[model samples]
Target: MNKLFAFFLAMLLPVVLFAQTPKMGEFTQNEIDLKEISYEPGASAVFLVASGESRFFSNILETNYFYRIKILTEAGKEYADIPIGYFAGSTNVEVVSAIKAQITTYTNGVPEVTTLGKESIFQVDLGNGYKEFRISFPNAQVGSILEFSFKKADKNIEFLDGWSFQRSVPVLFSNYQITMIPQLEYKMIGQGENFYHRSEKSEGNGVYSWTLRDLYSLKGEPYMKNYQDYVDKVEFQLSRYQTAATTSGPEWTDHLNTWEKLGDELIEYYSVRGFYRTNPLEREVLSLDLSKGSQKDKAEIAYYYIRDNFINEGEDLIYTKQTLPQLLKSKKGAPGELMLAYMGILKSQGIECNPVLIGSKGHGRSDIVPFPFLNQFDEILLLVKLDGNLQFLDLSDPLAPFGYVDLDKHVKGGLFLEKNASKLIPIDIRHNSNKLVFSNIKLDTETGDLVIENTIRNYFYEGLASAHLVEILEKNDKPLEELFSEKYDALEIRNVKVDDLLEDKNMYNISFESVLKNAMSEDLIIFNPLQISKFATNPFTQEFRVFPVDFEYAFNETYTANLVIPEGYELDDYPTNESITIPGSPIGFSYSTENLGEIFKITARLEVKNPLIPSSSYGDLKFFMESVSSKLTAPVILKRISIP
Candidate 1:
């Protein structure tokens, strides 16, 4: 009987060890109960244990990372699904271990477990550059606890995205550990919360760890920067390396310590493969009646030559290996290559133009640290100095206006890569943007019906965004008429005319007509004079504010309406003219009504004078918007005149 028992114990030991949870604690049936985590209010799911560790192999020069997550949440099951992306080259990363996931549930005081099969996993090929591994938890349900683990091996040290402790969901216990060899030196940078509960340093073993508990979920806010920028996370930047007695690596400070050094490095990096050295196609381009134009005119000519001739590939990179001659011959190149060629052309013509690097809006701000970090910048433009003024140009977009960049690319500051030295420059959008809306309302004296005709014009950056919205609507097979009807159900719309779809213009115009309902009564006629007000409700609805408001750019929206009074009706009451401005903020709104005997005039203007609003001004901003919304939805009451 003793010998038989020993044999069974040996077989089951391996199974029991493999099923153990992460270092936070051992998994139990009690963890599957939803009531265990009911204290977390407004959380979709609660992470029971979130732990990960990375191991670096010095002999093989590779890093292996393993992570495990145990979660319990029937309400927010979306967190149970995971996606891991890997590059598709020979020198890229790959998943070396199989994923293990299972769901545990308790019923009638009995615990039941269901393991996921290989069929639940899927791989997607992302076209030459990358691929994705996706897995879905099996039997995922409320009151079910899920546990999953996976491992990834990567040879490229640059692919280390680091670890994030705070996520969109609340975490009960979070921990991270990393063990590295003596050859690699890393600069550690952290964001969000500063304090950690546990910090352990290895004893001559090159291991580091951090632990935190009961982290709150990151709330979603409107008009804020990228989500990744606000998460509590730790990242590593490989600053140097050593082998035996030799040391060699990137001198982060020497290369990017100052604005001048950063600019010089950028110019040198982009000028590789003799790009922008000499433009063989410059003579041919200049010969087309553009050789004799002024400096500004010639610059425009060169820009169109590149914009119309080359097809823009939307890859975001600082440098390209494709030579200028090859790009010219093929008439196809990435955005970087095309912009490089444009710079080369401008240089060939003796025009003064420098490359300006900026961070895209969705990519977050570029002001993280003064260190030389190339990953912060994702787009490049040209800063042309003509007649003692700077003109910004973006040739990557074929449909972009002549002297303006994309709305998202109009960042506040950028690094200017000058030939001799580099410097930081500020960009403003108020110089090239404007929005105007006009409405003409005619009231039928006999029928008490309102016919509204509206004309809207958007220029420059505002125009680009408006055009994109129209394009998306058309692409999704959604008509503007249908959308307008859905938004204003009390109106019947017709004669929707939009112009400048095929032409290249600095601005776009949209005109439409709508007949409003509930404007007629036996003794009273009531209607809203501002028919084209865009903001029907305030978007800043959160009770507590933490993040700064980033509008991306300063903008002005103006509405002017001309309402004709019916012969038998007289104005009983109207919205009072009022103007309000925050004490020190750049936000302001004004509404005015004029009682012309036959025609009533109404004007409303909302102006965001600055692109950024600090959190200190949140209360005033919210109150101002609330007042604007209330006034916009108020009705203008009119009473029938008795026979005199």
Candidate 2:
């Protein structure tokens, strides 16, 4: 009798453990009765349970995912329509079988479940070798609990997807489990692991698991580069694998186990190293007259020659899809190919340069983990050593200056791909005067209108961006006044003129006139001194920030306004001269006003010598920005004198 009872208890133990794990089409009373998460009081939705498991079956890697969410508000209903995306162009991974989803609601303590039909699942082709399978829960409402599950199969173990514990909504419980086989070795990289509630490893069965509870949602801040970089997540990379060679056993092979090994692999790749050896544009490069300028000047000439001749296909890819010959013949190629061709030309002219791999801003932080993961990078830029100075150039944009790198690609550092010396190097971002505005303001005595003449100068990256905008407007046959009108909505812009557009200079000038109607009343005239204020509003409005603020580059914005008082009006009130600075930082703002009998001169200078502000300094930075905004938008009041 004792033996029989023990056998029955063992059989029931497996069922109890399986029931503890969240399953599809099942909900507890507590989950159904939940109205809102206590920790996240303002959250629209909450993830009740999010779990995933991955294991190898018959040498094939398969992963299963399950998510249960509780909708607490009208906005939470948007989560009912879930879209799962996968790379359909590759033979590596695929969505297995159909997705299962259900919506559960309770009425008067009685539960009702509505299942999603197979025919309701929609497939959307998201171009560029990607597709999404979308599923919507039936009868979803504010109090509905939406649950969905799906499975994926991967033929190649190298493409293992990482797990994110946090999402845009609060998560109550999250778990991830993985079972590893003895034939392969994987290195685990984790971020925010300190937040984990349970981390267990069963070495006997090669099973690893991590769990987190009551995690707040991740929200974007003003100057955050990418929220994904700060999320709590874990990823696995295949470090070593076993291959069948002999009848005795499988042989172990190292795969990207170190940064040096990864560097060597990238050098041997056909699209990178082969392109340099071939030098398809050698003939075209020799025809140019590069003999007149210095080495730096000659490098700039070659940069423009390639930029103007070859059209960019507008794709940000690290590896080129076509050979150098194919690209040169077609006269157009991806940005990587064009940059490589530019490198070849520079090398022929005895210029020193190397290709640098960077993960763009949208691609997340390049150096988040210590592991040298190749997938982390997506863009390549040319780093040239000229005149004893290093210059980073993004040849993708024709309007970009010789030493200009796009703000999105301005990473802290990147992998400098030099032959046998490939390693990470610090990127010294060059600083240039970004914007300067000078405005002359006067009141039209007869019409009671404010007349303003403004001259705006943009330099470096700012100049390149403005040039691109002007080119686009010209291509569309739009008036330049539209730019100012959109910016200064309270004024009417006219006689707009742009200078130095598409020229060799790294700056452009814009001059325009504006008229503000009814700016003056019978007794008083009120006007804002700065017509082209840099800060329309304080950008740091959030109470707290989780990520550092990246302003991309250091810049100086100087605004000078000369106001000529009306004939019979006298200054009653004006903005006071003030200065503010953040302690221990190179950020400061100053506003000064000079009251000369008839002319009022106002000058405001905002200097941000350090572009990146750490999250710890967000409060001081926010206050500083708020002060600047208040000073720039302060009103200057004038009164009309009555002769007794």
Candidate 3:
């Protein structure tokens, strides 16, 4: 892919000039005296001007970057240190020029400039073939203006990092200009919520420029998936190029424009098909007894056999680093390699399975564009047909149950690699993460105390998370009571019993006894019936959200409590029965109460049917969560009755 991108960039090289490029070290009065950005008033720092100019010359692509920032507050002083990074291991890319930085401060309207000296510049190796050039601006302070400029040259033109108009700090003006030849055709993809100005000049060479002004800083919100998915940015992909033709018509070459061709190339270059054909695990597969059970049962045996036998090195890579035989001999490999071995075993037993390439949750959205960009995917899962049903399996997590896909890998779709049938397939898992709680409470009139017995059941992903937490706590020699106490405030817990935690089951159970002190106050008793509250406080604190809220997966939390009212007190006030649902969505919440003679039963369930909620529905979701929190934490009041 890198070579192909480099070739396309080489074809775009021509003598071109950009007149709109900003000159370094120039600052306007408004930028110098800027106190805060009008759009983003709370921003500590603001980018006054950010510009980039790129051109291919002499078989090398050189990009010049200029940035001017104003530090409005003390926290903004951290911007004084800037680190420019590049892949040092790649000979094709390098920092060809020295970095220049200066800090400008005003004293009674008089501008004073301090230039960065060579002593303040240093280099650091960031491991994994990466290195960073650190530049420390001299005498940086609040209300100071910092300016920096550097040139980066890449022999591999595919290293075009494109441009991001918006950042964590507000950007007043962000511009990027690229010079290209007419022979090559490139596809430009722009994303985010911003209007941009685009212009093209053709003076024997093509000069394309993009300019975005006054872009607000994209702030991170609760439950946001990936910042890159919503940040204002532009990317370019080489689509087609014209070749010197010897025949009657000119020839145009397609550069990975189709998913099918990209899949074919991946198989060919990575030797994926070769590994399948060679059956690297044939000997191991033959040793396993497979003729005893049904296809699904056999698949389970094969999955567990590979999962239990092989050690995962904890890397979520798509390709295998070692050969199958080498991995088998070592008994340890990356998740992808082990999955491949599992696939080999399944294939040997005539089971239907294929590798699915996916971009995990933190990797950003997979369907950003229709273009076949291979870099979009960072991990691979197995798509198998068992009992005529499709299931996605990720062996990355050792404790994850069979047919369990990691929550991070629960993307909208994945590229199913099945020879000629390779295509994008939806990832629909029927399982949900749920937590069920049943609490029995008794109020003591004399001592003003409440005794509670709670039983909690966690299913699917929730159970896996609980199991991991249990493992960690047990490793540290901490009692399970600590977990319960930390979770429920103002409660004393005892007699904790955990079941099916380390076992390979879909659900885990935890039962414990707790006492809530001071339930009665003078003539009244106030208590919260819920033993396990999902939301103690509203997660959606921000009034407005620019990005979608990703809950990771659909979840359900049900809390059922039976409170035995004391003989001296009668129920006076309780949370009213109410049901609320987001219109046109599956998200809902309900709280109901029942009076059964002396026993008061409270049932509440919070169901989020859709994990990903769009920003447009954020207000409703926020309101719903606020209501749920209020109802769950609302105290049940009981007034003392005079002796009759």
Q: Which structure among the candidates has the greatest TM-score?
A: 3
Which candidate model has the greater TM-score, 1 or 2?
A: 2
Q: Would you list the rank order by lDDT, best first?
A: 3, 2, 1
- Cα lDDT of candidate 3 equals 0.76
Clashes of 3: 0
Pairwise TM-score winner, candidates 1 and 3: 3
Clashing pairs in 2: none
On residues 257-374, what C-alpha lDDT tens digit does candidate 3 reach at each position?
A: 4777777766664454334644324565345677768778988887777778888887788877876557656778888788877776676667788888888876744353667778
Give the TM-score of each candidate.
0.78, 0.85, 0.90
Ranking of candidates on TM-score, top first: 3, 2, 1
Give the clashing pairs for model 3: none
